[model samples]
Target: MTKYVSCRHHSQSARSEHQGAVMEALEGGRENAIYRKGELVSRPASHWTMTVHQLLQHLHSHGFAACPKAVSIEGGKELLTFVEGETYNYPLEGPIGSLMALKSAAKLLRRFHDASESFLKLNTQDVHHWMLPSRSPKEVICHGDFMPYNVALEGDVVVGVFDFDTAHPAPRIWDIAFSVYGWAPFKTDEDDKMGTLEEQIRRAKIFCDAYGCTRLEREELVEVMTLRLTALVDHMRSMAANGDAQFQANMEDCHHTAYLQDIEYINKHHQAITLGVLGEIKF
Candidate 1:
């Protein structure tokens, strides 16, 4: 990550060593244009940040610190407290790519869901428009994209989860499905490193155990997974049709085809997938 010394600090340019993590925009986050400078990261705020900010503040007060603390918005960008840790970027390998890492993510997500129950009462006014509507009365805020790259780590432990751009109110199963796709990576094997289907399902079951989902929730897993992927394909196609540069490129690159294939596999093996999730792991 290259450093970016601010023009305001022209007089102290020679003392550049005093700067914290330099103003380098880390890639891999598809939604926000993010840049890190010193002890702060600046990114353009959206309709969701305000709601997310309130949620983070609440979570912080309630003993959850796995997310960036909202600082202030200046110059059309919101400044956030920089969390120091290695991000689990793409093509996950080694310790960071193991089932234990997935377990940590599940635990953190469980904590967030537990804490987020009070968020609605705290901020009843102007719910963030970006949040998807609740499927029913029983819903919590889903991180939307709780993938490997979004999680930060120290060794194999997941320390932080960034990228709140997709936070929304939805069923617990909805969030679980999304996490399974990105973390368990339910997609078709795009790399030789991807484990066998049984291995993947076992890992998914491990995640569920760590999350402590009930038997009923376990039964709902496969269906939710299918629905999540189907909706994703629809959204991607819609985005591409709407002329989104990213989605257009994804379509041209056959990402859509890959997603469809994954959905088909999940549906074909729905019964087995449920059994895998429901089966007890003997520690």
Candidate 2:
């Protein structure tokens, strides 16, 4: 990570050393550009940035400190405190694939949802905006993209989460279903898959149990997962058609095709998955 330092505060050699470490820590590929200076993360500001910042502040006031603190916007960039810890993406391996990681993520997600419920209760204004569309029965604000890549981990324990760009008002199950897809790794893509279908189903059960899901939520999980992915595909195509460069590139690369395949995979095994997560049938 390259560290950016003020010329007034340090010698040339010290600044270079800081820049290298900081930049290394911040490096990763995603749809949006991200930069870091000192302990602040900088990303392009959007019309919804202030609304998201309000939600973050609400979470913090309610004692959920595992997320970023929204700082000020400057020069068309939104700044947030850089959360410390290692982040992993697809192809989960080592600590990322451990049982501890799965359980911890589920627990943390539950905490986040509980805290967010109050936000929904308190904020009655219609001035808020989110990148993702709100869903039916908006019980709590959903961390719309609660996947492995979006969380920060210390060893096998997930300590923090980031990327509120996709945050939206949705049901708790809506978020959990997509999260299970990522962590249980219900994917056919060779680059992202971690286990066989049976293994994935088993992991999903572990996640549900850790999160203390109701039987109703468990029964609805498989169906919700498929619907979520379908919605994702439609959103990608719609955005690409509307000239969003990131989604345009993704469409060109046939990223939507991969999700379509996963959707089919889930549909094909929907019955087995429903039974497995419900503990009525073993995987």
Candidate 3:
């Protein structure tokens, strides 16, 4: 049996250059470790710890108030204030609330992306780039995992965002694709608005319009969505093979399985969905 250490029992030790093991005690089965030094959470030599710290520092500097404040604990574990909000999983009873939530999320992403552009150019010491995609000239910071489950909503408004383990620098389009792929859900109708593809298309338009994306960019939605979906499938497979139970369960589910299997469907109907989203915009 795995030994469990209480959060209080863990002692703060000098920051080491070793990858710390995950503590299975945290809720949501978070892979965390205790660390000393820095008032914010720091995993001495862990890639995720470095990435999360970078993201938090960037957001805090830019006055992005939606992320958790990292706190350093006695042990190697870093404590992030728990965000309080419900996951925007099931569709809202009314379309207005859902629209509001998507709009808010887009605006937040826009702000984060814009701020990250400047940060990327700055040289910081002891920074280890982890999971960062090849940096393109047009690349900004990408929230590698910009799914609905990572976004917290309060009464139809996006309150906070969590999970920056995959944060990296990539093209602005990558960020847009990641968000839309999950929010619009290219292949599966699981997130279809009120149980219909038509409604899903309508909501997709609302999401794109709020983000102020150009028509050409919207047209490439299908292509970008496919790339994002394919990347996600591979990511899930990797996580499962590595013994991530949550990802394994998601991969085994029929809905998620269809989401992975039906990539061809989205590729085939990309134009139609693009037109539907474009038509909804009054410009």
Candidate 4:
């Protein structure tokens, strides 16, 4: 029989000495361990169980304040202070708010990537090696799922990023691609519930401009975004077929349809989107 632990029932007294805040692990699903305080922090078991504490320790050593400070817990669960904020889901009703959120996401990515660069010199192990077979080389730590849902917003502004399960060492472009695919509004007209293709492209440009990405980076960004989007759709399909409830709900929500639509949109307007992002760069 499988012994189940209630993350929610876990006491606050088990928290590590490094953390001065109250924290608790939420119930259900080992994919990520959730905590509540001011905001919810979702730390993936795959990454958090292996290296998140060390990663957080390293970040603190480096003087970074944006990431969650890891704390020890009973039953080997990790604890982190919840970052209070709103989540960006559905559509942004206004144009200005949409643009601002995208720009904010880009800035956040810049900070994450800059911080990740420091890890390159460290002797970190590749977590992916223990997973399925993949040709991608493990490099700097990549926030695998840097999408709107994983980010927390306050007053239409991105304030904190919560989920870090997909966090692993991979090419930095992979992280950028992940963000662009989602925040760039890389969805089809059918998928877009509140805006047009033109509006999405405009927002994408704003994000790219805010990041100060180079022309080469823009081109690579487009390519990687396309590849990652395709791979993600395939991965979700496989998971849904395997009776994964979350993946099932995601698919039932017409996610695959939206993904296909986005692919169609990309094929039809790759040149335009590429030029739009490149044009946004000042240098």
Candidate 5:
């Protein structure tokens, strides 16, 4: 059975060290084991957590504060300082659907990528374990999943992002492609889609513009978006086949089918989207 856990983002209650803190569960697309306590969030730790923590530290050292601070790992749960702000899921509406939100998210993603570049250059990959395999050109550590729900917002502005479980080394476009897929949200799911294809393309252009995406990146955006979503579906099925209960449950609910449908939707409109985002034609 699929379980949905929602926890309050802010809390003021105090606790003694001897007393056990409350563990408020958090919900995400793939996992349900996350929990929040006062100012700290805890989730199941994987083999790659140390490497991810190193990346977080590197970002923090470079003066980037929009991501969670890796506190410590204990009893198989990785603890991170909670980013205090509102978070949202599907059916993007209100502030999350605003142009400002898209622009801020895009800019923030760019900042994150830029901040991570030095870390990528300083570290050797073979020594570190990552949940997802590193992609070529190793531009930055992709947040792996930078969906709306993963971001913390103050009004329409994206202030911080959490849940770094999927962070991996990949090209800028590899991450940007997936981020745009969620922010532009070329979703075919009834509950998740926001506007028409034209509207979506316009939003995509706004995002790429704010992030200052290269002409080359814009030219190849549509193909990358489709490829990214297809990779997600493949990963979902692969995890399910490998006995990951969360993924198996996701499969039961046909999440992979939803992604596949969206991939088709993007491909159907790829030309217009490519042209639209390229600013060559108005939709």
Candidate 6:
């Protein structure tokens, strides 16, 4: 038998040191999620939570205010300051679909990578965390799951990023690749609501320009796109194999196959993508 706990089921008593804040359920966290009293968001703590909290604290100290601030652990859930804005999910369209938005997303990621350099050695791999530690040579803590859906918007401006469960040590290119893949969204023409292949390529370059990637980093862009998503496919397989219920369902729905398809597509057009984003890949 399984026990279920509602977000509202636990709170401080009237006479206790802490007072209850009403928890309103948020729409999109993969884990159980609720926002307390309009100021704090709460989610079940995983082995990675403590480490993620530490990283968030470090980022806050550095002047990047785009991510959540860790608050406290209460009722077995991790409490965090709620970032106010909108998250554009898959099939990204609207202001975020524009070239300006793409540039904003890229610059934001650059800011994250710049601020993240200090935490490279701090993330000593914990034995119980589910995600893998990155092994890149020019590593910093990459926001491993950066996507349009996870980005927060303030009107037409890209203001913040959320969902840090997958943050880990990796090269700046690791996050930059996904920033392009998710925003310009490097997908088949049918799935790309943003624009034509030529337009997508054009916009991808704008993103790279805004990110200020060095010649060598631009040289490695397409390859890192392949590496990043292929690792996602492998991670999905491992999760399904390890009996993760949601991953099992996603595998059944051919989610890994879809990722593999995109990986193949990215590899197939590797040269084009390279040229499209960087004009010419420098060795």
Off by over 4 Å in 1: 1-21, 29-32, 124-126, 131-133, 280-283
lDDT scores for all predictions?
A: 0.70, 0.81, 0.60, 0.61, 0.81, 0.71
TM-scores for the candidates: 0.85, 0.90, 0.72, 0.74, 0.92, 0.85
Q: Pick the candidate with the highest TM-score.
A: 5
Compared with the true structure, what per-residue lDDT tens digits does model 5 show for residues 86-199? 777777888888898899999999999999889888886457888888888788889888777778889999899877778888888888888888888888888888898889
Global lDDT for candidate 4?
0.61
Better of 5 and 6 by lDDT: 5
* Candidate 3, 96-193: lDDT as tens digits: 24678878888878877777776777734326566544445545667776656567777788777766666777677777866765565543444442
| Residue-level error in angstroms, candidate 2, position 36 | 1.2
Q: Give the better candidate number (3 or 5) by lDDT.
A: 5
lDDT string for model 4 (1-283, tens) is 0111122222233332226766554443343445555444444344345465566567667765566666664454555666455554434444224767788878887777677667645854444232222226654667677766666566767766654545667676777776776676676543344456666667677787787777777787777777777877787788889997777877877767676776777767787777777774222
Q: What is the lDDT of residue 30 in candidate 4?
A: 42
**Residue range 153-212, candidate 2, lDDT tens digits:** 899998898888778998989999999998998888888887888999999999999999
lDDT of 6: 0.71
Which stretches in model 3 have alpha-carbon errors above 4 Å?
A: 1-46, 73-76, 91-97, 124-127, 132-138, 185-194, 241-256, 280-283
Sliding window of 10 residues with minimal summed lDDT for model 1 = 1-10
- After TM-score superposition, the amount by which residue 75's alpha carbon in candidate 6 deviates from its true location, in angstroms, is 3.7
The true-versus-predicted C-alpha distance at residue 261 of model 1, in Å, is 1.2
**What TM-score would you give candidate 3 relative to the actual structure?**
0.72
Stretches of model 6 off by over 4 angstroms after superposition: 1-22, 29-36, 121-130, 189-193, 281-283
Off by over 4 Å in 2: 1-25, 28-32
